[model samples]
Each structure stands twice: as structure tokens, then as C-alpha cells.
Target chain A: MNSRLKFLLLNLFLLCSLSAMAQEKINIGEKQAISSAILNEKREIWIHLPKTYNDSSISPAKYPVIYLLDGEINFEYYTGMSDFLARPPYADMPECIVVGIKNTERTRDLTPTKSQKKSPVNPNVILFGDSGESENFVRFIQEELKPFISKNYRTQDYSILVGHSFGGLFAVNVLLTHPEYFNAYVANDPSLWWDNKVLISKTKSYLEKNKTFPAHKFLYVSQANNEEQNKNWNSEMTQAIEEFKGIVEKNGSLNYKHHFFESEVHGTVSYPGNYDALKFIFKGFRTDIKKLSKNPQLLEEEYKRFSEKAGSNFTPSETYLNVVLKFMKSNDFKESEDYFINLKNSLYPKIK
Target chain B: MNSRLKFLLLNLFLLCSLSAMAQEKINIGEKQAISSAILNEKREIWIHLPKTYNDSSISPAKYPVIYLLDGEINFEYYTGMSDFLARPPYADMPECIVVGIKNTERTRDLTPTKSQKKSPVNPNVILFGDSGESENFVRFIQEELKPFISKNYRTQDYSILVGHSFGGLFAVNVLLTHPEYFNAYVANDPSLWWDNKVLISKTKSYLEKNKTFPAHKFLYVSQANNEEQNKNWNSEMTQAIEEFKGIVEKNGSLNYKHHFFESEVHGTVSYPGNYDALKFIFKGFRTDIKKLSKNPQLLEEEYKRFSEKAGSNFTPSETYLNVVLKFMKSNDFKESEDYFINLKNSLYPKIK
Candidate 1:
């Protein structure tokens, strides 16, 4: 209660405060805006850099980036899913930078092939609006936005495009047209029925024309039970999605997957579907028990390739390596033992 | 450049800087350490508040809380996953708060009963150690920790307990012994084989004794294929999990789900399993397409109960109401229309 004791307590409080400040919150991500000439405006983007980014103590790393559409609302989903998928225990997907592109003009930017025909049923005023202009949006992303991100952040060339609904349509269109832009595309319940099913029809014809897709380009399409889940569901959208899935299934050259999520409805499918999409796209990246646990010695060679593919100086995280070590012996996994020993020496070399 | 131009540019830059300051980085959560008397140690805990936590202008809301084990690494996953699950387009769950409990002594706290026999095999010193003080740990949580959170934050009565591995064992132990603390229990790949399958045997006996549980409590158990995935995997752990699943299946009184995650292995099931666990526990919290899209009039009464269940003053979010309005005519959904009109007036009163 005295002034000296109070001063000591205050100093102790300040010290505790300073130490805990770093751990205050998980620094999930940052937001910034890009001045875009293509869109003739400034665009907002959310960036979640991986744990490996900007820490000088750890080895230098470049992470794959996901350029996600509907960034304002959906960015957190990608950030959450990506962070969970890439972290300890699962680590199924590589750690990556997630860039969420917030929408300024949803209909104008996301719509690829704008419809000229009027709605047969007098659409709601909010539902019907500006037609196309997605090309300029794509240009804004490719020319202005992507360049800006790469210049400012730690990123890799193995990029991905993620979108939902109309944004999903944008991702699909880009995969078919600008194939080189992203390595993988995830379209969750895409609006294939847009413009009187023009996208679906165009995609079918496009697949027929192009026999071979570039290698390693993966596309995952997720569909919900629209008709079954929603009574007022757009009939055309439902039917068109079925046809599009059928078309993609028939295309042998394309490395694509069309998944029917029967449990989810039109709106609620994004969360679980996108989570699955990430796992599907990045298959064979993690140390699966089925594949590698049988042959414990092969872990060394497999990890080398994993490191190469992840494009980062990858090592089995301490938690993962410990799990293996708990069950397996060093004599059985000679190569792994040596790798860890050398890594240990490099980290904490004995005094000369 | 002229002096006037330079001055204009500088002022513009200042304005932009000020505007962007608010959106600099997403404030994910905060951290604090609990001084525990039972454990005779200080334990770290992380807290993630919802979007509507402290904003005086929006609405006063109380959020459900999830107390997660192994808070150090998994905090990011919970923070990311919770933020996504409670946000737009897929707000299947309510905007709940998350509290992650970090460990000072893992084995000492997470195990239920001390093992009389040594580990089946000579366990890796780095991977194994002393255990069997979960009772004291649980006491610390129920006594010291819970009170601190309730005192510090706006929390609801509904709460969830989540854990993985040995942490999962602790979750099961607490659920069986102290069922009154949490509304939901999620054990992701619980270490049922601990202390020579003592926890599993105890659970079977516990189930036999308790014929009826408190109505509102829910438990979700996830299992992974250890033996099938790993050829050299421990048979004891695998068989123990099967028996545990069998026990849960035969018991009819307990409202529980025992899911076998065949696709995932021992280490990787936590990510997807925890995600599924959240969905399972909060069953029927979200608006369904089939239920509402037809009668849209039913949205009001349904949301009232949902709000009560979620323990928040929950109304239809703006985006959700707007989506409903897009397809249905104003006359079609009178109840929903009236609700929105009053909500709109309350939100923006100067319409005249």
C-alpha cells in the first residue's frame, strides 16, 4: 500500500505487459490497397504471410500464394483453412501466403461473359446490375495486383486461384483461358448457369477444341445439392452444374475433379468444400501413414522431393519428426537419423 | 513539381495513411497467463473474441466459448477456424469466443491415471515422460481459469472442450467425470490406450453406471487408422480405439458420435476432425435452404429459438436478409419483410 511497494508492483506489471505483448494475439494477417490502372481505382487486399516469412532466425523461405476472390467475407475462411492445413500435425498442404482480393464491384469484376438478354422473371434490382468487365479485373490482378504482391511480399511461382459462386466462375474462366496464371484452381459451386448457361456450353466446346491441358494444372470443382436443399433454388443453375460436371468428367486430358457435396446446401458448402479442395489439390505432399509408414527408411528420399515441390527449405517439423521417432527406431530409419543428426550439428555445433 | 502540387500530394498521402490505419492488420486475439495454485505453476492461455465482442455501437452480444487444449501451436488453427465458421456466407456456427490453454507440463497434466507398468516399448525420452495428474489440471481449469475468462469477457453458458492426442484423453476423462462443466466435448483421436487402456475400460464402466445423461450435452469422438496406415504401427493402440468405438456404439443413452476417419492417419486427423466436430456439436444452428426457402415466413420464429440456443441477440445478418430478398418477392415473405423493415428503421432511423 506504501508508495515504494506500489512502484515495485507497477514496474512488475509493466514488465509482464511487455513480455506478453508479443503473444497478445496471433498476428493472422495484414490489409493493404493497390492503386490499379486497369480498374481505374484502388483495390483492397488482405495478405496472410506464412509463419516462415520475415523471420531472420529461421532459414529463408518463399511460399505459394492463393489469390482468393470475395476477399472481404471469404478471405478469413482461406486464412483459417490454409493456416490449419499447413500447420503442425496435419501439415498436409505447404505453408503459403494468402492474398484475399476484396470486391469493389462484385457483378462487374466477377462476371466473365456478361449476358445481354433480359431476365425472364424480372430479377430483383439488387440481383441484376452491370454486365461484364471481368477482363479488366483479370488484367488488374495479373498486371497490377500480382506484381504489387510479388514485389512487396515473400511469394513463390506455384500460385492458386480460389473463388465461390460468381467468383468461382471467374476462377474457372481463368483456368480455361489464362492457364499459366495459376497452378491450381478451386471453384466451389460455380455459377455455371450464368448468362443462360453460356459458361457451361462454352466450357464444353472449349474442352472439345483443346485436347491436352498443360501438365500439373489442377482444377477442383465442388457442387452442392441445390434442388434438394433449397426449394426456390435456381433450376437453370442446378441443371447447368450437372451438365458441366458431366462435361468435365468426360474430358480425359484435363486433371480435374468434380465433387458432389450432398450434405451441404447452396450457401453452406463453401466452408467444408474449400477445406476439402485444398487437401485434394495438394495431395501426396504430406507424410501419409498408409504410403510411407510401412517403409520408414524411404522418408529421407521422399522428404527431399517434398522439399523440392514445396519450393521452401522444407524439413519435417519437430513435432512430426518426434511422432515418427516415438514409434520407429533409429536402426530402422538410418537415413532419417543421419539427417536429423547433421541438422542438429548445424543448429548447435559442439565447441571446438 | 510546383509548390502547390507538392503540398497537395503530401496532404493526399496523409489522408490515405490515416484512412488505412484502421485496416492495418486483423486483430485476431489476445493472450494471458493463468497463475495456477493447484499445479504450482503459471500456465499460458490465449483468448480470441468474436467480431461483435466489444463494439458498443452495433449490439450487445454474449458468445459461446471453446476451451482448447495444446494452445501454443493450435491457437492459430482455432483462431483461423473459429473466425471463418462464425463469419458470412457460412455462419453455420455463432460468433463464439475461443480460449486456448497452453501447457507448462504436458505429460504431467494430460494423462488420467498413472501407469503401473512401463511403456509397452522403451519410449523415446524426448517423446515420453511422467504423466497422470489430469485431475489437478482439470481443477485448475474449472476453478482458476474458467472464472478468469468469465470475469474478463462476455461469455455464454454454452461452452465446448476440445483436445487432440493425450490432450484428447484428458477431454474424455473430464467428460465422463465432470459432465456439468461443458455443453459439448470433442476428443480428436483420443489416446485411449493410455495407462494400459485404463481410460477406455473406465469409460465402459462409466457408461454402464450412467443410464441417462443431461439432455443438452453432446460428445463427438474421432478415430484414425493407425495399424492400417502404418504396417509397423502398434497393434495395442489400434485395437484399443476399435474397442472404444464399439463401447460408444452399444451405449444408447449417451448422445455421441464415433466417427472413423479412414482417409487420415494418426497424426493428420486433428485438422479435419476438429472442423467436423464443431459442425457436429452445433447441429441445426444455421438456416437451411429447404426449410426456409419455401415458407420464408418461418424465418422469424425459427431464428428466435436459434438466437436463444446460440445465447446471443441474433437477428438475420444484413447479407443473409439481402440474399433472401433477391429471390422472393416482398409480398411472399411478410414476416421476414416486417422484421427487416423494423430492423432497417432501427439501424437507420432518418428514412422519412
Candidate 2:
């Protein structure tokens, strides 16, 4: 072949290869850093907005927020999970913004009481020496992090705090120390045994003072299978959780759920625990689409009931209304379709 | 102010604002499209590599791949879940490459038979008009898609097929027809009643012919709470699943598990179902780090047993080995630490 023709063929091959290799990224969220005065350090957070949050066709919507501890470990699955659960038509819960807090001092920030112990594996070494500054950490979350999020994102009043292990201890500490901070709390196999079960005593004192958990509050605690851990180093972990479960169940005032995961170890419990917590926290959020197709008015009634229980007002999302409209339109339910269109317009007025 | 000074101030303000708003995306995967000869159409696929896939410190690793149906709906969460479950120290399964296939013609590609029925919502309207070309679809996957993946990625021989609803039906159909295609199959709330339970008959005939499933193959089926569905138009779905479950259990030859998710509905079952399916498929894959500290040889023994059952030669991943070495070194298990170092060096030899 001539030199010019050879060069032309090479260029063509390169062009085809480049086109074939062109790829699009699947981005779930973004990383943002904030300087926290309370903690006296810069904290990085990962924020994930729900799928409909940026849809141009729909009116902008506010979402309930979840403050996830152990951001680096849990953020990806947690965001994916919340989105899956919040899909329209069969949404188990409302769309949510997940702010995953990355750790600067994991032991110090998550432990409730300053304590030190010999390492389980090496008795000569000390562990958790710099532990127990959760008060300052919670302060940072409340005074700095929450404001940063609210100022930046379209967030609803309703929020949830979720954590595992020491992070779970931080969640319970926050609920005990500042009950009004979050609408719901999830602690997955928490280190209730920390400082000899300090949180259990705090829970008792709070119940004695308040007589019942502040109205409309919810707490979901998941206990991992301790049969193995009991044989290992964390014997007190399961016992403490069981003791706490009895006290809360006896009080029967807090909207409380305690699930014992028989098959999961402490390391694995948070995954399934988070799923169950969402289901429990938003027990009445799922509205039947088939029923809605028949009785259009039932949508408002269900929302009203759910709002009353959630202690927060929540209207149907514009995306959900659109889904309902499509379902009704495809089914030839003209009246129901019209009903949902009106509902959508009333809730999310088009700016133009 | 002087004009030059004013311009400098404006430029400084712009730089500050831009830096403050700078964001990094959390990307899980990438999208790629390929033209399929068997199906005679272009198909898009989302590919998610494990977190360690591109780590410069580690050698390139070949990984088991999961072919997830309904890429648009399930890719995000499925990728996140796999990564979470594959974390070191308590890794439940091996890190895997996830290839999610996006659908073009849903009914036509997923259904096993060309059949049409009246729309459940609108009796006058027909549904699934151009139904049934799953044979062609499977051929596309086997002949075109699999080769495309194999050529471009570092892939282990083992693979899994996962689906829900119509996609789930497609997975089961493939298992019966092309049992050797994948190592495992997961079907969440599968539409077994599709085309009048055609797959159930196919399963019966396959069992009759083979007398037993191929060795080392696994299947997991999850049934959702069909109470609401039973009251609706999908009354037959639950019965059909139950019938399939009975027939499979009676055969007692396939490595199988059937779970009933009492809380999950059809639309929401896949989230939890996928988690359970992974645990079931890789039941003995988790090695105890605590135990390994004392008995370093136990790691190889466990992997051997697991591999024997899996019919795939499994070994400890470099990441898992690193985690183990760290655990041992920190805990002062000097001998065990040395043992793991040698194991890692032998398994992942550095190119010097």
C-alpha cells in the first residue's frame, strides 16, 4: 500500500477505537469539605441526591435527609439502597438525601465516655485510648453539618441518623443527649457495652425524666448474632443490647423496634439492619398503586395518616404523581389520570 | 478603587467561589454500547469494577462477573452491594465485576414464548404485542456480549445471572435451557406465571431429561409477600411460585434455596433478595480473621473446602491477605503475619 493510504487506514482505526472506548460514568454523589468550628477540624462529607432531585421536567423537591456515620464504609450502599426504596409507584419511603460523614477521629468522635482497654488480641497494647468525644462530634453535626446541608440542599424537616458499632454508639448518644436533632435513629449492633453500657443508664434516666420518649420519635436497634462473638472478645456486646431491649420494650413509650439478626455477624449486620430500619421507620409510607387507581382520594388520606404518624408533613412527590398519571393513562382511567394531574399541579406549581 | 485593582479583586473573588464549589464525583461504573449480531441490534451495558480494580499498588486481578438484568433499574445498588459484601477481614464473597444489560425491547427479549394477553388495567387494550424472542436474546448474550466482556476485561470463569420480574423469568429460562452458561442464578419475585407458567413445564422436562441439575450449580429464588398481589390481578403469581418451589424441593438434586420475604412486595423484593442470594451462593466463603491469627494455615484449608464445593478454584484475594497481615502485625501475631506475607507474595508475585 502507498504510505498516504497506510496512514489513512491507521487514522480510521484509531477513530473507531476512540469511539468504541468512549464511556460515561455512573455518578451517585459528590464530595464536599467543610471546616467545623465545634470539632476544630475540616470534615469531608459525601452527599447523594435522589434521582428526581435534578430532573428538569419536574419542579424542584425537598427530601428527607439521612446522616450516615462511617461515611467511607457505608455511603455507597446506603445511597443506592435509599434510592431503590424510594422509587415511585411502590415507594417504601420518600426520596432522601444521604450525607455520609467521613471520620477524622473515629474512636474519639464515636465513643461516649473516655475509656481505655487492653487490646483483645494483644493484652500488652492499649486500645480506644483516645476515645469518647462524641459530645463534641454531635455538636459539630448539629451546629455545623446540619446547617451546611440545609443551606446547600433542598432538605425536608424530617431526618434520620444511622450508624454501626461505635458509630452506632454515637447515634444513641445523640438521641439521648439531644432528642430533637433527628426524627428517627438507627443503631446497628451498637457498642452499647462501651464504658459498661453507659447509654443504657442514660436511656433509663431520660425515660424517668420525660415519662415517655418525646412524642412521635422512632428508634430502630438491630442486634447481630452474638453466638460467635460471645465465644470471641465481644461477650458483653450482645448482653448489653439485650438488656437495653428489655428496658425499652418494658417502657413501651418510644416508637421502638429491636430486631435480632440470627445469621449476621457484627461486621455484616449493618447492611440488612439499615434496610429493615427504613422499612420500620416508614412503615406506613407504601401506598398501593392498584388501590390508588380505583380510589383517587385515598392518596391524600394515606399521606395524612402517614404525616400524623411521622410528625412531619409530606405530600406526594411530583415524580410519583407523574408515575401515577402514566399508570392511569395507560389503563384508560381518565378520571384517575385527571385527578393525579390536578394533584401534581396543586403540589408542584409550574413556575411559568 | 483604581480600575486595575478592581479587576484583580473580581478575579480573586471568582477563584475563591470556584474553589469553594469544586466537587469530586463518586463514580461506581461506566456505560458502554455494543452492536449484537445475534439479536441484530445495539445493546448498552453498564460495567462496575471492584474498588481495588485500578489500585496501582495491587496487580491486576481477574474477577467473577455478575450479569445483572435490567441495568437501568438495578445497576447502582447491585454494584454497591457487591463491593460492600466483598470487603476484606470479613469478606462474605469475592470481589466481582458487574455487567448490567440495559433492555431495548423488554417483553420481546425477556419472554420465552410469543404470547399476548389483555392488559390487566384496560381489558380492551392488548399487552406484550411483540413478545418472545428470549432465545435470540440469550444467543446475543452467549455469542456476542460474553465474548465482548471477556475480550475487554479481566474476568474469572465463574459468573452469576441475576434478575427480577420478567427479567427473573428470563434468568430461570436460561438456567433450564443453558444450564452451563452461569455458575449461579438469582431470581427475585420472578414472574413464573408468565406465558401461563411455561417455565415451570420447562423445568419439569429438564429435570426429567437430566435426572439432576449439573453439579456445582446454584440457584436462589425469593418470594415476596404476595398478599396484596393476590388481592389484585396477579393472583396467580404466588401460586405459580409455590408450585415451582414444591417441584424443585421434591427433586432435591439442584443446589437451591427458596426464601419467602413476608415484608417485601413484588416491586421492592429485589433489594433484600439480592443480599440473601449472595450469602446463600457463597455460604462458606467467609474466613474468620480472629481464628486466622492463631492458625494461619486455616485460610488455605477454608478456601480449599469452599472451592471444592464451588467447583471453581478459589484463593484468598490480595486485598484480603493484606487485611489479614495488617490484623496479625498489629496484634503482635508475628509468626502468622510472616506466614500471610509469604502467602501473599506467592499468590501475587511482583514483576521485578
**RMSD to the hidden true structure, all candidates:** 6.7, 4.9
* Candidate 2 per-residue lDDT over residues A181-263, each given as its tens digit: 99999999999989878999999998889877888899999999865665645688988888988998999988999999989
lDDT of 1 by residue, A1-352 (tens): 5565556556555645654564465667888888888889998899988765776654455678899898876776577668767764457887889999998889899888666544443443245368677889888889988888899876767788898888888888888778888888989898877877777777877767876666667888888877442333356667777887777777766668778887676676777778888888777667653334355546556667855543334555444554455434533555545555555455435566
Recovered fraction of real interface contacts per model? 0.54, 0.70
Q: Judged by DockQ cut-offs, is candidate 1 incorrect, acceptable, medium or high?
A: acceptable
Give me the TM-scores of chain B across the candidates. Answer: 0.79, 0.93
In candidate 2 chain B, where is summed lDDT lowest over 10 consecutive residues?
B14-23
DockQ, every prediction: 0.33, 0.41
Q: Model 1, stretches more than 4 Å misplaced?
A: A1-23, A88-90, A116-126, A227-233, A288-335, A339-352, B1-23, B88-90, B116-127, B227-234, B289-332, B339-352
Q: Tens-digit lDDT track for model 1 on B1-352?
A: 5565555556555554644564487767777877899889988888888766776554455677899998876777676677677664446777778899988888889998775444323343233456788999999989999999999888777788999888888888998889888888888888887777997878777866876655567788888866443333346667677787777767665668878877776676777788888888766667653345455546667778765554444566544555555434443555555555565455435434
lDDT of 1: 0.72
**Chain A TM-score for each of the predictions:** 0.80, 0.93
lDDT of 2 at A135: 89
Worst 10 residues of 1 chain A by lDDT: A117-126
Indicate which candidate wins on lDDT.
2
Give me the displacement of residue B252 in model 2, in angstroms.
1.3
